[model samples]
Target: MTEVDPLALDLPVLASLAGSAADEFLLARLRADGHEHIRRSHGYVFQRLIAGAPTVTELGAALGVTQQAASKAVIELEQLGYVERSADAADSRIRRIALTDRGREVVQLGRRLRAELEQTLLATVDPADAAAARRVLVALLAASGGLEAIAGRSVPLPSD
Candidate 1:
């Protein structure tokens, strides 16, 4: 039997680790800014809401979660003042979920924090190298049929 090299992780594993690190950084900064109630999972909801208000069912479909689960999350976010549910303009029979002002602030903060993270990385990594890394990541995402999701800023939750 040959010993496996710990440094030779698969691309998915490496990507997940990098994403987790970035999320942690963003969360910490948000906490400092009084958004301690925000959680990483809320990102999926925010991504979909960014385009427009969506029904709970639509949100669940976008998140790849059960409607019940999506509703539960929305309820939690509503209580935290990050989101609100209102009657749909077209049909009062249906309700739509929208981000609150607090939610928008967190989203804007996250974008700025991500830009800062990139700048921090560039401080140590050459700009060309960073560009190449981005290209590689984009290519990987495209190959996995996720480019559209990225373009739409919608990321589904991972299946259990």
Candidate 2:
């Protein structure tokens, strides 16, 4: 095994580590809540749906995936009873996907767990240091043109 050097870590690497840790924590909590079918990738779709229903094409564009891929994911989510698809009122040709009540519950639970995790971490570090970390992270996010720009990238990046 190669010896790892913490001093070689860069911003992108550190950010990715933070994301993976958060995803692991969230998925573990979701499993405890009886959502064994859900996976980390689905979090991107869920975050988009939480705002309101969006057509598969819109979802695909936001995540930088093909419509077919988005449709496939949505189909699995529908089969699992987390989301539902309906014909768009203004355009019957377009199908809009929305979270079901069960889906909303799952999203809410994830949000609650995330907040709790943040609080717990904040407690572990010095208050000033934690505040500085938040500023740096937020500035990095803003530098990338904010969440909207970040979410438009291809697979594997969590939207929220």
Task: Give all candidates' CA lDDT scores.
Answer: 0.89, 0.84
Whole-model alpha-carbon lDDT for candidate 2: 0.84
Q: After superposition, how far is residue 19 of candidate 2 from its true place, in Å?
A: 1.6
lDDT per residue (tens digit) for residues 1-160 in model 1: 9996747988777887888888898898998989888888888889899899999999998898899999999999999998999998889999999999999988999999889988888999888988998898898898889999788777788666
Candidate 2 residue lDDT tens string, 43-135: 878877877788998888766688898899999999989999999999999889999998998988998999999999988999999999888
Q: What value does the lDDT take at residue 90 in candidate 1?
A: 85
- Find the candidate with the highest lDDT and give its number: 1
Quantify how close model 1 is to the true structure by its C-alpha RMSD in Å: 2.7
Clashes of 2: 0
Give the least accurate 10-residue stretch of model 1, judged by summed lDDT. 151-160
Considering summed lDDT, which 10 consecutive residues are worst modelled in model 2? Answer: 150-159
Candidate 1's displacement at residue 17, Å, is 1.4
Error of 2 at 112 (Å): 0.5
